[model samples]
Target chain A: MPELKTKLKEYRAIFDMKQGELAELVGVRRETIIRLEKGQYVPSLKLAMDIAAVFGTTVEELFSFE
Target chain B: MKKKNNYRNFHIITIIVVTVVMLLYFIGNIFPDNKWLTPVIIFVYLSSTTKLIGPYEKKDELTKINLGRANGITLITVIAALFVISLIGSNSDNKDIFASEVYIFTALAAILMRSLLFIVFDRTPESLGGDE
Candidate 1:
């Protein structure tokens, strides 16, 4: 199975958004964001879009499949 | 913040109460003379409330999905266990135990499994909402 590599931490830092802040924006728990950034869990389409939108980037820019 | 504290407090209370009930069941079985204990156990089972274990309306999608998976696993386990239990009960000469008791035990096991899985996979309440 291909794994998704996220640049979430970098983009989030660039946007000055804490994990909790981003999670709230995406309507999910902070732990979900943590798991996503750690590549331990995958997000749904809606969640991926929500997260990307929060960082003002496209999902392709935020995450790469490897 | 207070709500989160209350939720944690509720969970602690639930664990303590469930532990006591299980201990009573164990002791009652070991020392059969405790007729009074049987009634107590029945009362505890009958009056049991699932305030801490009931489904929540506010769980996030990830948490909900994890919970669903946990329930599916628990259900499969219960079905497999009941098949084995039925076989054993039929083979054993002891007929003292009723089918209802077996069903109750199965239900309790399922609930316990679900609760354990939920606690293991779930994050702190603080992570679910507004930041501190």
Candidate 2:
């Protein structure tokens, strides 16, 4: 099953947040953020929700199944 | 999010604590400084290493899969290690009581299985995880 990822800069640009800022808000390491952007680590449901909450969006809007 | 963060933080803390305690143990052993402190240091070392599950793995049952793959791997490795140890010791009449393998097969198996479990079964239910 392929999990659709957040677009490279969509959430970040929406919040005017840097990668490090997003990582800190989501309670993951900056390296995790880097890897996640490069399609390495798939964010967990909790992390997905947290990120969506940060940008005032829903999890469904942030991620999709491909 | 914070829960996951604490898991990573706890792992770092454990590594630091174990490293310091082990260093102290070696220093105590070599220097022969305090007879009172050596046993205490050894106890700390054992306690820290035995705490493999930590708080996160304990919560996620799949990571605690000693009943399946981990246990099988551990059992086979231990049997093999014991065989090798016995073979080596039996070669001579005088048995070396303190002989050991630092990275014994059992230890290797445990680490590998633990890491595999952590990566693949990290959040999945045990019903859908591991090898028996």
lDDT of each: 0.68, 0.54
User: What is the C-alpha lDDT profile of model 2 across A1-66, one tens digit per residue?
Assistant: 686565636777767778768766776645455555655456777877887888888988877667
| Colliding pairs, model 1 | none
How good is the docking of model 1, by CAPRI class?
Answer: acceptable
Off by over 4 Å in 2: A1-4, A64-66, B1-83, B90-92, B97-132
Model 1 DockQ (Cα-based): 0.25
TM-score, B chain alone, candidates in order: 0.59, 0.42
Strongest candidate by TM-score: 1
Instruction: Please give the DockQ score of every candidate, comma-separated.
Output: 0.25, 0.04
Q: Please identify model 1 stretches exceeding 4 Å from their true place.
A: B1-17, B28-57, B122-132
Top of the candidates by DockQ: 1
Error of 2 at B54 (Å): 19
Pick out the ten consecutive residues of candidate 1 chain B with the lowest summed lDDT.
Answer: B1-10
For residue B10, give model 1's deviation from the true position in Å: 7.5
